[model samples]
Target: MNRLDNPILQVLESYKAAVWAKDVNALVALYDRDAVVFDMWGTWSYNGIASWRAMVEGWFGSLGTERVIVDFSEARTIVAADLAVVHAFATYKAVDADGLELRAMDNRLTMTLRQQADGWNIVHQHTSSPIEAGTAQVIFRR
Candidate 1:
C-alpha cells in the first residue's frame, strides 16, 4: 500500500500544522477522546484528551507571542487495518516574534493511532528527550 494513503501518516500533516498554529482545539481533535499522552515536559503521563489539553495549552501559553516550528524525521508507520504505530524523531524550535530562535529540542516520539469512522485518531503518544548522565544537562539538539 502507498504510505501516502495511510491514515496515520496523513494525520501527521494535520498534527504538524496544528502545533505550529498553536491551535489547541485542532490538536485535541486529532486525538481520540480517551487518548493518553506521555509528553516531554509533563511530569506524569496524561491520561485522556481532557488531560492532554492542559499540556497543549501550557505549551502555547509559554510561548506568549512567540511561534514554534515543528519537524519530524526518520518517521515510519506500520499499519494493520484498524491500528497503526508510528515512531519518529521530532524537533521543536521556539522562535521570537521577530524570528529569532529562543530554544530548540530534539526528541524521540511514538504515537499509536486507531482507525475510526472519521479517520485515524492518535490513541496514545509518548515524547522524550535524553539527558547527559554526567552533567545532567538535556541534550536539546541531535
Candidate 2:
C-alpha cells in the first residue's frame, strides 16, 4: 500500500467509525482545511474545516442515541498522480433511540481525495440516489 492509500482508506474508514461511534471530531479530521460538503436535501453548504467541524458537531448532538449502520459495496478506487477518486454504492439504515428502524436509503458516492502536506483528505464529495435504469430515455406519448 502506498502512503497515499493509507490516508484515503483512513478517511473513509473514519467516516464509518464516526457514524457508528458518533464521533464528530473524528469525522472532521478526514476533511481538508478548505473542504466543502453539500447534502442534496439542504441549502446549507458546509465550507472550511471549522464550518464542517461544526456541522458534524450538530449531527452528533442530534443523534441522541440514534445509530447508523452503513453497508458499503462495490468500492472502486482510481488514482492519478496526486489525487484519487473512490466510487462506491452504499445503503444506510438509521435506527432511532428506541431501536426502531427510521429509514433505509441507497445512494452512490464519489469521494475525491487530494494529497496535502498533512495527509490525504477528502476535498470534494458528490452523492446521489440511485436513478431508475430507463428514466433517462423518456419517450413522449403519442
Candidate 3:
C-alpha cells in the first residue's frame, strides 16, 4: 500500500474486512506480537499474538455471518516515518447473536501502529461507542 494511502487507515480497513468475514487468522495477522486491544468487553488492555488469537476465538461464537458495512468518517491519521496514530468514527451493520439485526453502533476507534520489518502492525487499539453524537463519555454496561 502507498504510504500516502495512510498505513494506519489501511490496517483499520483490513481489520474491518477480516472481522466481517469472521476470518480469525487474518484478523490476528494485522497485529504486532505485542499489541493491545480494548473494546466493549473491557480492557483487553494488554494483549499479544496469543491473546489476540484467543480474543478472536472468543468472538467466534458471536459470529453472525451477517455482512458488515462500515461507514467511516472523521478519519485522521498522524504519521511519522515508522509510527502512526489513527482515529475515526465507524458505523457498522451486523446481525446480533440472536439473529436480529443489531442496532447500528457508532464507535470511535483509535489505533497506534508501528512499521516493522514485516510492515505496518497495530501496536494498540482502543474503541468506544458514541455517547449522543461526537462525545467520548462511554457508558459501559453488562
- What TM-score quantifies how close candidate 3 is to the native fold? 0.76
Which tens-of-lDDT digit does each residue in 8-42 have in candidate 1?
Answer: 77677788889889999998999999998887773
TM per prediction: 0.91, 0.77, 0.76
For every candidate in turn, the CA RMSD to the true structure comes to 1.8, 5.9, 4.7
Cα displacement (angstroms), candidate 1, residue 106, comes to: 0.3
lDDT of 2 by residue, 29-71 (tens): 7888888766544645767888777767777787777888766
Per-prediction backbone clash count = 0, 0, 0
Q: Which residue runs of candidate 3 sit more than 4 Å off their true CA positions?
A: 1-4, 96-101, 130-142
Candidate models: Cα lDDT each: 0.86, 0.73, 0.75
Which of 1 and 3 is ahead in TM-score? 1
> What is the per-residue lDDT of model 3 for residues 1-142, given as tens digits with 9 covering 90 to 100?
4434766777877877787778888889998988888876655465778887887877765654555555667888888999988888877767655556665667778888899998899898898864545665664321
What stretches of model 1 exceed 4 Å from their correct place?
1-5
User: Which pairs of residues collide in candidate 3?
Assistant: none
